[model samples]
Target: MKLKLVLVEPEGMINFGFILRLSKNFEVDELAVVRPKFQVDHEEVLRFAAQGKDYIEKVKVYESYEEALEGTKVCTSAKVSGTDTVRDFVLPWELKEYVGEPEVLSLVFGRESVGLTREELSKCDLLLHIPASKNYPVLNLSHAVAITLYEVWKQYRLERGNLPQKPSEKDLEVFMRVAGELAERFVGDEVKRERILIGVKRLISKASKSELRSLLYLLSRCSSFLKG
Candidate 1:
């Protein structure tokens, strides 16, 4: 299992720096930032990033949530309450069942204040919430990243039971491109396109590599059949 830490519209530079270190601490391979307000090369952020700056520099900046998650399964972390889709918050241990298959995982963390919006949450196949005290159930961004990444790595080790090379970025891109094409074909209504895309993205994110490949093959066959 490969994991990337995505921070969406983070406000503070210090938090960014700390999270960068946390990514290194947890051995996260990729880091992506979506529409950040602060400068990536800011002194405060750089100072803290320090040795982790190498990873920080490699951080991909995305204009939108969808673009950032183009080639990976994105799991968004959100608050656990209200009329939200978040019914039962899955513990870190339960995360094992969600992962295990060979796939790239993008663990998305939203803003420091408000977590992922309902619209953003819709894109995520699964919602991961740190089980906090009911009294006060909010966590800092860096802390959340640390906890989530740690749990994911732990579960990955247990399930994989063997070390293997992760899928290349090019492979992930090809898969996502195929998925996008399939969505465009099957889901044509402009009014409902957004909704269908979200659902489809969620479904694909959870699929194993083999399953995704199978879906791509099926999609290709369907396209060929139409052309024929």
Candidate 2:
């Protein structure tokens, strides 16, 4: 999984510097800033970033969030509170369940004072919140980034340790096709068939390559029997 850290409209140079250091610590593939209030090469930024100054220099600056997320396959926005319309909240620890090994995954942090706006949060594919005290629910910009990155790094390490070989995109595509065909054969109703196919896709998405291979073999045998 390629991890990209994005800070939207960041105002504090010191915080930006700390975030750059955090990005380096977590081995983030790229660091992006959208419409930053301070200059990328500000003296304080370089001073705080210290050894991570190199990362700050290479930070990608964008005019808009859309441009910042150009190549990102999965995007998650950090928010203090959930919106009524966008209520699919995934805690920082549970991020692995929502996120697979995508080629590029973008984790977006909003401004300092107020987190992501409703409109900005709406653009993100998932919403992630850290569990904190209700009295002081909000966290400092760099601190929030640090926590989120740590959880992501933990998940990456777990995946590397347990599952050496994960399923590729092609493997997932083939499984989805076969699963859809099987669902169609079993269900005559169009709506029911679509729902079943979608459920099957989600199930296969969480499987490892070896597990998916076993499932495909079983499905093939069952398909033959049904045809016979």
Candidate 3:
């Protein structure tokens, strides 16, 4: 399981530096920053990062959240609060259940002030929140990153023992495209087609690499029959 840490528009150099260190400590495969507010190589950032400057030096910068997660199979946005209607929010410890083995698992931490926007959250596959006091649920940027990374690390150690390499984002995309085509061909109603596609995506989202391969095979066989 490869873990990627993404920070969106972080303003404080100290926080950025600390997160750099945390990423290294947690053995993150990649560190990405989206439209950072301060220079990444600022003295303060270096000072806080200490020995983790190597990770900071290789930090990938992106203009948008979507670009940052280009090849990520599973992405979770850190949020302190969300709409009551959105029931998919999961606690940090429960994240492993929502995310099966994937080539790249992205953990997105929002800016220090406003956090992730609803639009950004919608793009993420899941929402993760650290349990805290209601009076002050939001946590510092680096702290949140540390906690989330730690949980994921623990989960990785527990669940990834002897597991096969997971499917990549490209693999999932191919499956979705094939499923969409099948839905369009067999399901006459637009609404029904959309629903079937959504259901397929949800199932694929939780599927492991072998499970996805089996599903793709089944879909391919069915698609061939439909064409014939």
Best by lDDT: 3
lDDT scores in order: 0.74, 0.79, 0.80
lDDT tens digits by residue: candidate 2, 52-156: 888865589999788887433333444443446574577877777876766788888888977777778778777887777877777898898888889988887
What does each candidate score in C-alpha RMSD? Answer: 19.2, 13.0, 16.3
How much RMSD separates candidate 1 from the native structure? 19.2
- Per-residue lDDT tens digits for candidate 1, residues 1-228, read 567778889998998998888777778877889999999878899799878866676688889788877434555555665465643356666776865554777788899988788777777767777877878878888887887877776776534534433444565567667666766777788668777766766666666666777777887787778768
Of the candidates shown, which would achieve the greatest TM-score relative to the real structure? 2
lDDT of 2 at 64: 77
lDDT of 3 at 211: 89
How are the candidates ranked when ordered by TM-score, highest leading?
A: 2, 3, 1
Candidate 1 regions exceeding 4 Å error are: 70-74, 82-88, 157-228
- How well does each candidate superpose onto the true structure, as a TM-score? 0.64, 0.65, 0.64
Q: Can you write out model 3's per-residue Cα lDDT over 57-128, one digit (the tens) per residue?
A: 679888877888844433344443455533257887877787776778888878788887777777777777
Candidate 3's C-alpha lDDT?
Answer: 0.80
Q: In model 1, what are the clashing residue pairs, if there are any? A: none
Using lDDT as the measure, what is the rank order of every candidate, best first?
A: 3, 2, 1
| Candidate 3 lDDT for residue 115 | 85
